[model samples]
Target: MKKSLRTRLYACLWCLGMFVFLMPEHTNAQGAAPSEHLVFSFPADAVLKMHKVKIVQSAYTEYFEMNSFTSGYAGLQQTPDSSKGSSHTLISSLWDPNTSAGIYSSVAYQASNTYTGRFGGEGDGYQSINPYNWVMNTWYNQVIRAWKSNGQLYVATFMNNLSTNQWFHTVTLAMPAPSNFLGSGNDAFLENWDSNVKWNGAFVRKAFFKDCWNLNTSGVWQKHTSRYFSANAGDSARNGIYDRAFDAGYDSTEDAYYMVHGGSTTPGAGFGTGRTLTLPAQTNQGTAPVITAGVISSVTASYASGITTVNWTNDNTTSPQLSAKVEILDAGGTVLYTQQDTLPQKRSTTFMATLSAGSYTARVTVRDIFNNLSAAVTGSFTVSGRGTDTTFYKFKNAYSNLYLGVKDSSTANSATISQYAGSNSYNLQWYASTQSNGSIVLINRRSGKALDLPGSAQTAGTHPIQYTVTNGTNQQWNLVVATGSTFLIQSNMSNHYVLDDSASSTLQGTGIILYAASGTSGSANQQWYQESVSSGLSSLSGAAVSAALMPAPPVTASVLQVFPNPAVNVVNITCKKMNAKMWIWFYDVPGRVVKRVAVTGSPMQVDISSLLPGTYFVKYGNETVTFVKE
Candidate 1:
C-alpha cells in the first residue's frame, strides 16, 4: 500500500479519506473463533501462505442456473463489470489475472492513480489487467481452496508486512512461532497481526500507516513503514527497513502466482543504509491464502448403467494422505464430477464414477508435500441403471454433474436437467444396487419411468415374455464392466446387468438385472453366477422364452414418494402423468432407475423433493415403488 502519487499536494490532501474505508474479517455462523494464524514477518526469510473455499452445496444444486458454465465465465468474455449484461457467473478454476474477481458495476472506480484511486476496490488491488496475467500457469489466477482433513493437510503459510497504505484489519490467530514470519528459517511462525497489514494510507485518511511487504515467495512489495511530514509537525513515517532477499524461496515451481507492484516500478532503490528508494511498494490483497488440517476415513458409492461410483479415505499428519481425489457437487458449490483414484498403497482411498441415481457426495480430497491440502471427506450416493424394465432413469445432480441432459418427463423441474463439461453424452457404465434396506434405482434411456416410485410396483400387459413383480426389483437390469483397483476403471460393484431376451449372451437365456452382487468369474457379464441360475429366471434379455405371469397382477400404479430415504434437499415425486409424457424415476434395489424423468405431462399430483431427498426406486413401465424424501 505504498501508493504515493497524489501530486496536487496529495490531492487537496485526501479526498474524503479516499472514498470510504473497508474492514473485512468476515465469518459466517458456527463457533470457535479466530485461529486463522500467520503473524509477523521481516527478513529472516519471508514466506507467507493461506487458501480456503468452503461452500459446498451438493444434493443436486440449482439456484438461478441459466445453464451454468463457469471456471469463471469460460472466456465468453464480458466481465469488466458487464456494461449491463451477462452473469451466470460462478467461475474460478483459479485464474483471473486482473478484472472481475467480485464487485462488478461495469468497471468504474476509474483510476485517479494512488493505485487506481486507492485499490479500485475496498482498499485496492488494481482494477483490471491480464496478459493471461503471467502465462505458463497451471493454476494461479488465485482460486485456492485446497482440500483434506482426516487423511492429512497441515499448511501454515507466512508472508506478511501489512502497514504501508493501511488496511491491516485483523488476521489475529496464533499457535506457532520462532523466526518464520519473513526471516525464512521455517519453524512455521504465524500469529496474525492486525491482519498482517494490507493498507491504503490507513483506510483513506492517507497515512497513519501505509503498509506493504511480500514474502510468501515474493513478487514484490517490501517497504514496511514511511512517515511523510506533520501530524501538524511531528514528521513520522515509522522508519521502514526489513527487506530480506525477498520472496523467501523454499522453491516456487509454478504456484502460478507472482507479483511485486511498484517499487514505483524499480530502479536502483538503495540497498539502503540511509539512501534507499527503489520505490515499488504498492501491492494488493490476498486472503485465506491456504491452510488445512486433517482426519477422515472411509466412504464409497457406485452404479452401473446410470454410472456412478465414489471412494474416500485419509489418515492425516500435516497433509499426509499424499494423493486422493473425488468430487461431484451440484447443489451450488459447483464442481460436478472429478476422479483420480488409487488405493492399495497403504489403504487410504478415494475414487468416483458414472454417477446418476441421485443423492451424491463423495468430496474426499488429499494432497501433501508442502503444496498442502486436506479438508474434504463427504459421502452420499444414489446411482441406479442396469438395463431393462423399459429403461429411462437418467438423473444428474451433484453440482450439475457437468450438465448431462434429459429430464423432461412431466416437468417436475431441475429445469429439465441437461448440462455437460466432461461429456461424451455421459454414462459409460453407471450403477447403484442396494437392498440392505436402503433402496435406490433409476434406469435410463431418456426420461419418464413407466410406473415404479412409491406409487407402488405392479404391472401387467407388457408382461408378455419377462415382467413379473412380486417385488424382486420388479425384475432387475443394469450393466457395464471393468475392474482392478487403484482405480483402473471401477464399476463391477458385484456386477449384474445381463440383458438378451434371447438376444442371448447364451448359457441361460439371459434377461438379467439381479441386485445383490459379489458374483464373478463367469464372464459374458458373470452369466448370473450360473449353476442352474433360477429365481424369477428370464436370462436372455428375453422377448419370449419365459416371462408370463401378468393376467391379474398390475395394480400399484405408483408415482412418487422419494423421501429422506437418504436425501439432502428435496425429492418427492408422485405421478399420474401431469401434462403428458412422464417417467419420474430413481431406482436401485435391484429394479434400476438411476434417476430418470423425460417429463412432459403435469397432473400426477406434484411434489418433487426439491430435486433430491434419498432412498429411491420409482419406475414407470413394469411398475416399482419405494419412498422416503425427508
Candidate 2:
C-alpha cells in the first residue's frame, strides 16, 4: 500500500484543507476550566423537519470572568461530514465584554467562530452593534432561519433583547450544502471559552429557555416540546463542555415552555458532549369557554314576625335568560339556602326564607355554557321581629349600646342630641311617622321636637339636634333595614351618609353625628337596633313638663331663680322642674367646674365659700346662668 512522494504530499494537502474547512477559530487555553453547555435537541432527522428555529433565554446573571466569556446559541446542525468535513451553522448571542462588548449577535461555523475550510480562511461572523447596554440579568430572544434554496444552503439570524423589546439583524450566511448533509440537529447551547489562554475562573451563569418553535418549509409553526439528554465531560457522545448544571420543564402557568439548561462554572472540566432532555407525557385539552358577567344587582329584604322576603335584581339586559346559582349566607357565613335558577334578569326576583332574626348576605354566581364561572356578586340584609314593626321606638347604637337622647329633654328651636347609657330615660323614645312626602320624621316624645340637622348641613360629622318641626327636608330620614335586628338610619338631607356616633365612641354624651355609609354592614357605627316603646307623641305636651325644653325667656328667667346672692355659706337654687339626678356645675372664671352639687328638688341648698370665687357660672341641665359668691 506504499505510495509515491507526490501522492503523499497531495494527501497531506487535502487533509489540511478539510481541517481548515471544518475547524472553528476556537482553541482551549491552559488552566481555563471547560465550559458547561445545556442543549435542547430534537429528532435526529430534525434538519429535514425543521426550516427555522428560535429560543428565548433570560439570563439571571451579570458578572463574567475577566479572561473568558460565555455565550448561548440557537442553531441547526447535522452529523459531521467525515469525507468533506463538518458542515453546520450556529447563531450565537454572546455577553463578552472584550470581543462582543455586551449582548451582541454573531454567526459561527460550529460553536465559536465561523470558518470556511474548503475556501480557506475565517468567515464573516459578527454583525450588528449591541444597541442596548443589554441589561444585566435579563432574557434575550434569538432566532435562526435555515432552508435550502436552488441548490444552496442559507441561514439568517435575528436577536431581540426581550427585556427591552428591541431587535437586531445578524449576518446571513450561505453554503452549498443540502438539508441531508446538515450536522446533528437544531439545538440551544451555552459555551464558555478562554480567549486569553489563562484561567481567570469563570463566574456562575444561568438562563431560562422557553417558547421554542419550529417552522417547516411551508411556513407553518409548531411547538418544539421534546425530551433532551444531559452529559458531563467524560461522556464519549459529548458535543460540548459539561458541568453540574441542569435543565427541566418550567411546567407552570406563567411559563409552560419546558426550560433549557443552566449551570455554574466547573474549572478544570473541559467542554464535553451535548445531550437531549426528556419531557413528561401529557394529553391535549380543547379551548376553554368565554368568561361570563355576574348579574345580581340590588337586594331588598323585609321582615315581619319570623318570615323574611328577599328580593334582588339582575341587570344583564343583553342576556336576560342567563342562569345563575345563588346562596344565602347567615351572619356567620353559613349557607342557609342554595339554588340554581334562571334569572328574570330585568325585574327583581324574589327568594323568601324563614330564619331567626339576624343579618345575612346573598352570593350570586353566573356560569357560561362551557361551565366557565363569572365573578361573584353579593348584597346584605337583616331580619328582625323586635321593634321594626312598631311605629315608635328608641334606637340603640349596636357598637356603643347607647341610646339616642335629646339634651335635657329640650323642645327648643335647636337642641343638642347625643348618645347616652341611660336606658330608662323617656327622652330617648322617638315617634316614627311617614310624612306626606314619603320621608320619615322622628319626633322626640319628651321634647315634642323633631330630629334635625343644625343649619341643614348635610356634611358628614355634623351633630344632629332636636328642632321645632317644620317638615323641612333637613328633618326627614330614611330607615334602611339591614342585617337582622340592626338597621341604618340614613338622613334624607345627606343621602350618602347614615346616623353614626363620631369615632364610634362608647363614651356617654358622645354627639350623634353622620358618617359616609359603606357597602359592608359590619361597621358598628352604622348599625342601630330598635327598642319598641310608646306608639305616639300626641299624648305628650311640652307645657305638661316642668322643664321647658325651649329656652326660658329672660322675663321668665326667674323660673330657675337663684336666691341668696353673695351668700356666705349656703346658696338655694329654686327651680320648679328640678330632679335628684339634675345637677348644677359651678364654674369659675376660667370655665373649670369648681363645684358640682346635686339638686334633689326645687329649693335645693348648695354649700359655697369653701374656696376662692370672684365670678361663677352655674350650669343646670342645658342652661348656664351667671351669679357671684363671696
Candidate 3:
C-alpha cells in the first residue's frame, strides 16, 4: 500500500536514530581494562620448564597468567560468577600452529572433572579448564614437560599445591606434525578481562612470580636472570584511558619479582612501559622439596639368622622420598654390601649375609623426588656365634691398682666411668658376652649398662661412659693380651683407641677415657687385670654390698722433695725413704715423658737446662712432686 512521504520519512528517521544510539561512543568502549605483562626470556636450548606464582591480591573477573609460551598460555582465573560454584579455575590453552594449513591441536588426555573444547575469541585453539579453589597468599608450582610422541609434539601440565604438598595433573595436549617442541619465549601477565569499566579498574590485582627455570637439552636447570615489564597501550586505538595505577619491579622481601595493577597503584621510579630488571644469580639449580637429613634410630644384628636390620625415619612432610642407599662396612673400613630401597615411606631394611664374626658399620642416606640427597648417618653392630658369659669379674688398672666402677653407683645412662678402691658392690663387677666377631660387650652387673663410647666420638681424650646395653659396636671391646695377666681393652669401632687411666692419676675418682693405644705391650695406664669374683663375694645382695663398701682412705704424703724449685741450670732431688737404686721419671703436663734418670743415692743432682721453661712433675717410687724450670 502507498503511504505518505512525510510518514515514511518520519519512520526512516526514527530507524536511523535508533541505529546511531546503539553504536559504541568510542573505539575501545567495549575493550577490557589495562593489562600488564611480565615477559621472561629463557635459554635458547631449553626443553622442559618450571615456574612459581603467588597471588598477593586478586579480584573477580581477573586472570593471573602464570606460564605463557609461544604456543599458548596457562594461568589461574577468578571467574565473574560466584553463585555458579566455579568461582576459581585453572586454564591451559594451545593455539593451532597452522590454521590455514589444516594443522590443529587436539586433546590427548583430559583429566576428570575438566572441560576440553574449542576457543576462538582471541585465537583459534583448544583449551582445558578445571575448577580450582585456589586461595590467596599461597604459592603454586607449575611444571610443563614437552616431548615428541608418535610424530606429534605433546605437552603435559602439572601443578603443585605448596600449602598442601599435593600434585595434580591437569591435562595433556598434542599438536600435529611441524610443531616439534615448545617455543623458547616464556611470559606471564596480570589481566583484567572485565568489560565493566566502573568495577574493572576499581579493584586491586597483584601477584609475585619467582624461581623461573628451564630444563635445557642437556638436562641442566637454568634459571632466568632477566625480565622485561610492559603494559598494553592506553591510546585511543587501544584502551581509551591511560592507567597510572600499575607497577612491576623486584621485591627484595619476597626474593621475587612482583606485578601490581588497578586500585590507585602508582608505578615506582624507573618503572615505565618497557623496563628490563636484572636479578641476582641463583646458586641452586632448583628448590629442594626436602632438606632434612635422614636419622637412624637403631641397628641390630642377629647371629642366628645372619641378618642385620637398620631402622630409620625421615622428615618427608613436604615431599615423598624416592629411595634410600644403604651400605655396610666391616671393621677394617671395607664396604661389604650395598642395597637400594625404592619403596616410599619404608622405614626399615634388612641385609642378609653369611658374615664371619666381626664388627660392622651400617650407613644410610635418603633421596627425594628432586634428586636431592641427605647427609649420611651411621650405626654399628657385631655378630657372634658363641654363648654369652655370665661370670662376673673386677677390672683393675695395672698401674694404679684401682677398680673400674660407675661413678656414685648411678644406674642412669651416660654415667661417668671412674676408678675407685676395691669393694664388694656389684657396680665394680662386669660380665663379658662373646660376639661372633670376637668382640666382647662388658655388662656392668649393678647398672646392667655396657661401657660405651658416646656418640662414636673420633677425637682423642674422650671419656668412656656407661649406657644401656644395645650391642652397638661402640659398646663392644676387643681384649688383646698384654704382658703377664694384663690385657688392653680396645674399642671395637677402632683398634687404635683403648681404655686408659687418665693422666695415670691414683686419685679415687680419676676418669677412665679412651686414648691411643701404645706399642703391643701397651703403656702401664692402658693395661688392665681382670680378677674373677669369689663365689662367697658374688652371693651378696645390693644392701649387703652397700654396707660392706668401705670409705676411701686419704691420699698418701709424698716422700720426695726438690730444691731450687725455680731452677735455671741444676736442681737437687732428695728422697727421704730412698734405700736402693730407683728410676726417676720427669713428665710434662700432657703425661708425656720428658726425661728419665737412675738415682743411686739421696740428694742427687741433675742438670735441667735442656728442659723447657715450664712446670714439670718428678716421680720417684709412688710419689710425685712439681718443680719449675726457668
Assess every candidate by TM-score. Answer: 0.24, 0.26, 0.42
Query: Which stretches of model 3 miss by more than 4 angstroms?
Result: 1-33, 82-85, 177-180, 234-242, 272-630
Q: Best candidate, lDDT-wise?
A: 3
Which residue segments of model 2 deviate by more than 4 Å?
Answer: 1-133, 147-150, 177-184, 195-202, 235-277, 281-630
Residue-level lDDT of model 2, residues 1-630, one tens digit each, is: 122222222222232232222223334322222323233333332222222122233221111111101111233222122232332222222211122222112222221123322111222123211212333345554445444433434344444455544444333333334444223334433332222222212333333444444443433344444535343344211222323443444444424323233334332222233333454422231122122344455665554542334455644321122346667788999776565633222122233223456788877666522223666777787766442333357788878888899876667867888888846566888866444333567878777789998888888788888988766788878665443235678888745478887888999888888777777453777777766665321122211224433224322222354433334466666554565545466654322245766567755778886945334567665445555454
Taking all chains together, the TM-score of candidate 1 against the true structure is 0.24
lDDT of 1 by residue, 409-528 (tens): 222212222222333332211223332223233222232221121222222111111111222343233322111100011122223222211222222212222222223312223222
Whichever of 1 and 2 has more lDDT, that candidate is 2
Best by TM-score: 3
Task: Give one digit per residue, the lDDT tens place, for model 3 in 155-216.
Answer: 66767788976666676665754543555667777776544665466678899888777766
**Number of colliding residue pairs in each model:** 198, 33, 7
User: Ten residues in a row with the worst lDDT in model 2?
Assistant: 61-70
Predictions ranked by lDDT, top down? 3, 2, 1
The better candidate by TM-score, 2 or 3, is 3
Q: Each candidate: what lDDT?
A: 0.26, 0.46, 0.65
Better lDDT candidate (2, 3): 3
